[model samples]
Target: MQIETGVSLKPYNTFGLPAVAQTLVRIEADADVRRVLGDATLGRAPKFVLGGGSNIVLTRDVSQLVLKVEVPGRRVVDERADAWIVEAGGGENWHDFVTWTLDQGLPGLENLALIPGTVGASPVQNIGAYGVELKDRFDTLDAVDLITGRSVRLDASMCRFGYRDSIFKQALAGKSLITRVRFRLPKPWQPVLGYLDLERKMAETGQHQPTARQVYDWICEIRRAKLPDWTVMGNAGSFFKNPVVTEDQCRDIIGRDPEIVHYPMPDGTYKLAAGWLIDACGWKGKSIGRAGVYEKQALVLINRGGAIGAEVVTLARAIQESVYGRFGIRLEPEPLVI
Candidate 1:
């Protein structure tokens, strides 16, 4: 564990805000992880675990030690007749993991390519893109409790997966740092043709069903074109979780705005397309100070340059208020705010 005092977290976070960490520890090796956690000194509680820094925004300087996981390793745990068990260090870049699976002739993760984050943080949000989510392939994760310094394994069921939520993201929020993640991949996959853009892209390309690699490439292209690169600009990925509504609520939104898009939920509910709602509310290109909704995707809030976290949160609230005022639906943030 390499410890640095009073570290500026601008580069660590995708938001590019100048929040400072009271203590920043970058753990690379397994021993390094144990050393940091088991150390008697630097007795910081309520630590913040930062991965690729995409799915989070620090509203203010983190008042505790920030443990930025950097342990990197990848391996195939087992290969059965149809499935492959893939394990990665918590800190491995998520896109690279997808790329690795594709290279290994794995198929299920194709629809989720190019999502920016580390492997450990994926399960916390149960991250989804196009039509695939981490929960679909998530096997388990190893996390350590901050209070007890105890390690534990949480299986898929124990995770309590939901739309952009899990136990880790909620009850254990900012209190556990995941050290490893395991995912089940398929050598022979059940292809997901659920996303409209992907289905249309497949049709436009004159192929009924492209290969897993092809789907991966297409989705990456779509995401690249749709989202602003945080590396070039700055953002914490999609800032708001698409609001889920009841069946009756859906009817109301549809009655008011027939063009409202919705996806049916298994629980007899409906999820309003947040992008559609924001676009309908005319917030696509709205900008306030350095924080602004991405011009292309209304759901994605961007940090155009140097921006403050509070200002960004304010802009997000404004949009949330706008959508709520019009549709009677409340939007919740997807990112972990500190």
Candidate 2:
């Protein structure tokens, strides 16, 4: 692979945060990764795998060797009696992949439409929206070990999927580079409309039974109304994970603030709406330096204009402290700050 030096990372990341990669290499295929690992100077260097740059906040210039994954391909790999197995190159746009699935008559991924980032980063973040998460449809993935230059495959059980997290975000953080991902979309498609926004859409449209394409359209419309277009305004979607608390904690919070928004989890826990908490703390439309909370949706942190990463971090920290001080719940940031 051709190693380029002094690459501007502003255009690479969704936040448009100012940062430079000292050395950057565009990995277009599995062989590219092996080529890098086989190199003398590059093989030994600490590396950072970058996908769509949609889920990160670049704080400073990167010292690690940045491998920008750009592998591209998508197709229905297999059709089983029970499900449709689809595979996509890690570099494929996640939203486009979802749309393609719908176009191909696959319907299970409709609920996750319009999500930013690449296919490779989806499992890394365990991305979820509406009533569906990546883990719900994941089949398998292929990754190349950074140290060994050998490719490996992992199933859902091995990925260790959790709320907005996976093994890729934990033990395998920078140890492996994902080259491809496969999804298992089950047959006899079912629409997930239990989410509040989807429910509201159904109420507005007066359609109790919606098709997969209908669900996809509704999700797109809902997200567009709530989240700013990152191309126009710099942002990394939701800024924090919806904090999950025990029943007692939820009861205590509800006792103090009856209007608090929360949903009971399957295991008897409660998932608190992070945006509601931030808005409740009076952070909506508030700015700290060049970074500010999106007035449309409090969960998003946006760059006002030419905002730096430090400003975003500062604003996020301030919001976190305010939320903790009032609700005693520490809001965890969703983006990787590097």
Candidate 3:
């Protein structure tokens, strides 16, 4: 474990916000994590686990000891008649891992292609897209406890996966560092085309029976068209979560705004489009300081050239307030601030 002091975090996060880590250590393996815990001074100090830094907004310098997870490996650990078990290190790029799975003839992860961040971070947010979620393909995960330096393996049930949430975000938040994740890609892969964008691709291509690679390609295309590339335009993909409302709440909002975009959930709830609400509130393409809402998609808040974390927070708060005042619904941010 190589430790560094006063490390800049601007390039670490996708948002490109400026910040510094007082002490940073690259954890290349599980042993490195244990080593840090074994150290008297470092072990007692507060620590932060950083993955790909895609789903976070650094508002200020991190005073805690930052453990940058860099463990790397990927392989099909087990091949069952029912499913193929693939394991990947926490530090592996999520999109690259998805692509690798497809290359290895593992098709179940195609629908989740192009998501930013690392495999370790996926379970924390239960990252989902194109009608599929991490829970759908998750098998189990291995993590090391920061305090006791003990390793634990958690299955799907232990994960307690919810819509863009998991135990990692709740009970285990900041308590452990996920080292690896395993995926159970079921046999006889079936494409997930229920999402509107995938359906549109089907209509446009005239290919109803699409392969996993086709679905992957289509999702990449759709995301490229809709969301900005974090490398070029500094921004986290979706700024706010799609607020789910009860039947009565949905009807009340529908009554007020007939054109509000929404979708019915399987559990008889309604998921309102946060972007639609923000757009309706006249926030698209608007700016405050160096932060601005993406003109192409109001759901994305962008750092318009050298924007600070505070500017982004200010812009997000204003949008949230306006959206709540207009629609009587609160928009929760998706990214972790600071």
What's the best-to-worst order under TM-score?
Answer: 2, 3, 1
TM-score each candidate. Answer: 0.96, 0.99, 0.99
Candidate 2 deviant stretches above 4 angstroms: none
Quickly count the clashes in candidate 2: 0
- Report backbone clashes per prediction: 0, 0, 0
For residues 99-193, could you state the per-residue lDDT of candidate 2 as single tens digits?
A: 99999889899999999999999999999999899999999999999989899999999999999999999999899999999999998787888
By lDDT, the better pick of 1 and 3 is 3
RMSD (Å) per prediction? 1.5, 0.7, 0.8
Residues 1-338, candidate 3, lDDT per residue (tens digit)?
99999999988999889999999999988899999999988999898989988889888999999999888999999999999999999999999999999998888999888999998899999999878999999999999999888999999999999989999899989999999999999988888888888888999999899988999999999999989999999999998999999999999988989988888999999999999999999999999999999999999999999999999999999999999888889999999998
Candidate 1 Cα outliers beyond 4 Å, as residue runs: none
lDDT tens digits, residue span 1-338, model 1: 78998998888888888788888899775566567767777554557788888877888888877889987889888888977888998899999989998897767888888888898888988999877889898888888776666778999999999889999877887777788898988657777877888888878998776888888888888989888888888987778888888888889879989988899988999877888888888999888888988889988999878889888988988998998898888899888777
For model 3, the stretches where C-alpha displacement exceeds 4 angstroms are none
Using lDDT, give the best candidate's number. 2
